[model samples]
Target: MMDEAVLEALDAYVECLFAPQDEALEFTLSASRRAGLPDIQVSPAEGRLLQLLALMVGAGRILEIGTLGGYSAIHLARALPDVGTMVSLEASAHHAEVARANIEHAGLSEKVEVRTGDARKLLARMIQDGEEPFDVVFIDADKRGYPEYLELSLTLSHPGTLILADNTFRGGAVVQPADETSRVLHEFNLSLARDPRLDSILIPVVRERVDGLSIARVKNI
Candidate 1:
């Protein structure tokens, strides 16, 4: 297995080759840092992967459970066609403000909406309001919230919708699952695999450490 340094170098090599950051993306990271946001946003390579997945699915509408400084949101929104739109849920009002500013700076304000509130409550409200199904749902929030997020995301997805969750491997913790978060993530992966309405797989992603992105396509319902 590659050491952390090698893994990071490999990630940088991939990002340099295929996901070079633009001015907007650069500004997003800088602003996010200035605002003291956690540096837990997806890496550049993973952001590219998200964009590619969104494009591959021909996503017209996307839903994101986390909007950390709008870094990933910019990537996902860029994959949208002119009329395509996205709604991103952020639990922290401060983070939402930062994300909105970053998105605006990225010239994606018209395409993405960053809503601030409890994700579960917002999702429940969306369901109650009969929100239109999205073509893609990306969850990258609190690990403990993943199970409920997945269930809520399904309510907002249609057949063929793509659901992506980040940090699934949890630095290999899910392998042994000594902690509650790790155990929960392990079970989440299992549920994704066994769910009759979907077909899924966990794609390993490398940064400073090995994590995973869980991708599932809604087969029915």
Candidate 2:
């Protein structure tokens, strides 16, 4: 097996060779750092991967469950058609404000809208309002809320909707479940794989890391 440092270097080299982060995204990350937000945003390669996934599905409408500084939202929205719509939910009003500014700075304000509130509550409200189903849904909120998020995602998704959840591996603790978060994430992964309504798989983005993303496609409803 390759050393962790070597693997990370390879990942970075691959990204540099193929999909590098652009200026707007770079500035977004810098700004997010200056604001003292958590450094938990997806990596550049992962951001490009999300864009590729969105493009592959020709997503017109996208749903994002966690909008921290709008970093990933910018990537996903960029994959949409000119008239596409993307709704992002953020739990922190302050974070939502920061995200809005970053997204606006990226010139994506016309395509992305960040809503402030609990993700679960917003998702439930969307269902109650009979909102149109999303083509792609990305969930990256609290680990303990993943199961509920997946359930709510199903309600707001149609056949062929792509659902992506990040941080599923939970730093390798998921195997032994060292804590509540890890245990819930493990259960969430198992549930996603066994769920009859979706075809699911775990995709490893980084080398030797217990953190990876989950991709699930909804079956015909």
Candidate 3:
């Protein structure tokens, strides 16, 4: 197995060749750093991967949980058509503010809406409002609540809806989780994979952090 540093260097090299970060995205990252947000945002390659996946699914209405500085939101929004829209749910008001500004900087203000509230509550409200089913949903919020997020997402989705969950691997902890968060996340991963309603795969994305992403498509409902 390659060392983490070597793997990262290789990933960086591949990103330069396949998905170089553009100026707007660079500015978004810069703004996030200036705002003192955690650098837990997806790497440029991961963001590009999300964009490509969204494009592949031909997503129109995208839903994002955990809009930290709107970094991933920008990438997902960019994958949409001119008329496409994305609503991102964030629990932290301060983070949401930074995300909104960063999204504007990325020229995606019209395409992305950063809502500040508890994700579970907002999702419930969306259901009560009878919002249309989303084409794609991305979950990146608290690990302990992932199962609930999956349940809520299934409620808000339809057949063929793309569902993605980030940080599934969680620094290799899923293999032998030592904390409640890791154990729950590990269970969530297992549940997602075993669920009959969706087709799913877990992909290891090697960045500064050893995180994995889960992509699932609703099949029967």
Top candidate by TM-score: 1
- 1-221 per-residue lDDT for model 3 (tens digits): 55889878977986898779888878878888998889888888888889999999999999999999888999899999999999999999989998998888888999998999999999999999999999999999988999999999999999999999999999899999999998999999999889999999999997755689999999976
- Model-by-model lDDT, in order? 0.96, 0.91, 0.91
Query: Please, what are the lDDT tens digits per residue for candidate 2 over residues 1-221?
Result: 45788778877886897678788898899999899899999877888899999999999999999999999999999999999999999999988988999999999999998999999899999999999999999999998999999999999999999999999987677879989999999999999889999999997777445378999999965
Model 1 TM-score on a 0 to 1 scale: 0.99
lDDT, model 1: 0.96
Ranking by lDDT: 1, 2, 3
Best by lDDT: 1
Candidate 3 error regions (>4 Å): none
Model 2 stretches astray by more than 4 angstroms: 207-210
Give the candidates in order of TM-score, highest first. 1, 3, 2
Question: Taking the tens digit of each residue's C-alpha lDDT, what string does model 1 give over 137-215?
Answer: 9999999999999999999999999999999999999999999999999999999999999999999998998899999
Q: After superposition, how far is residue 216 of candidate 3 from its true place, in Å?
A: 0.5
TM-score of structure candidate 2? 0.96
